[model samples]
Target: MSKHTILGETAIQQLLLDLPDWKVIENKITAEFVFRTFADAIKFINNVATVAEEMNHHPEFCSSYNKVRFSYCTHDVGDKITDSDLKIAKQISELARNLNGKSGY
Candidate 1:
């Protein structure tokens, strides 16, 4: 399938199996990462930015004190989930794991 093609429910479910911390919510695959401190959270976000820039696939995120929630979807494809989104989500999850970011707030 094309990278930008919208994923169906079955495909999305299969993809999410490897991403235990992520879930489908309102058409987006999302996860929340909690860091020990606000600075750490910011650091994770910055790292994510670099990776996203390299991939040219940015995620929607919100950071609070020590928690950051990241959501991924292909807005150009009707805000639907796609392979590109899953790829970025995997990278983001790996980054969070490397930075000691806990999977939920």
Candidate 2:
């Protein structure tokens, strides 16, 4: 069995509280990262993609100029947040911090 399991409603709520930069909407845990330039944003996205692939949990990415939005959910688990999503989000958050990315609008 897979180690990454679907998170319950209460666990999801706690995860949101623990990950202040992330929010859940439409059952997906989402975050938007902003970079100083378009190139920087793309580079960060590539880095995130690599990590996601490694984790075997891909995210929905939408990029426009220097802004990128990521939404992570487990389609196999009824499009809900899962442990893998939480792990990948944490990894992405750390990568964004290292790349000098900013959160919020």
Candidate 3:
């Protein structure tokens, strides 16, 4: 497998500008999704799982009754944010939007 590049601070800042719901928390790009019900939240997570499989990049998430918090970072890239992290973050963001998951839950 090809090595992933670690994103520079400036590039990460620029990417975050476009990703309004995402924030740099620790070493990961993190976001939270709020759903009207637990089932909706789980459905959204299922959608994300498919995307992650396709992209071969998985994220860590914590789910409550009606909320899910996603943390994205490339473990292969020294656990730093990389282009893969940004790409997956965007996809997850879109999935959340389509599932009617509100941000900043």
User: Which one wins by TM-score: 1 or 2?
Assistant: 1
Candidate 1, lDDT over the whole model: 0.91
| Global local distance difference test of model 2 | 0.87
Stretches > 4 Å off in candidate 2:
none
Q: Report the C-alpha displacement of residue 55, candidate 3, in angstroms.
A: 0.9
lDDT by residue (48-100, candidate 3, tens digit) is 99999998898899999999999988888678899989988998999999979
| Candidate 3, residue 76: lDDT | 82
Model 3 alpha-carbon miss at residue 105, Å: 5.8
Q: What would the per-residue lDDT of candidate 2 be over residues 15-95, giving only the tens digit for each residue?
A: 778777799888899999988999989999999989988877889989999899999998877787898899888888888
Clashing pairs in 3: none
Q: Return the clash pairs for model 1, or none.
A: none
The lDDT for every candidate, in the order shown, is 0.91, 0.87, 0.90
Model 2 compared with the native: what TM-score? 0.92
Candidate 3 residues lying further than 4 Å off, grouped into runs, are: 1-3
Writing each residue's lDDT as its tens digit, candidate 1 over 41-87 gives: 99999999999999888989998899999999897778889999888
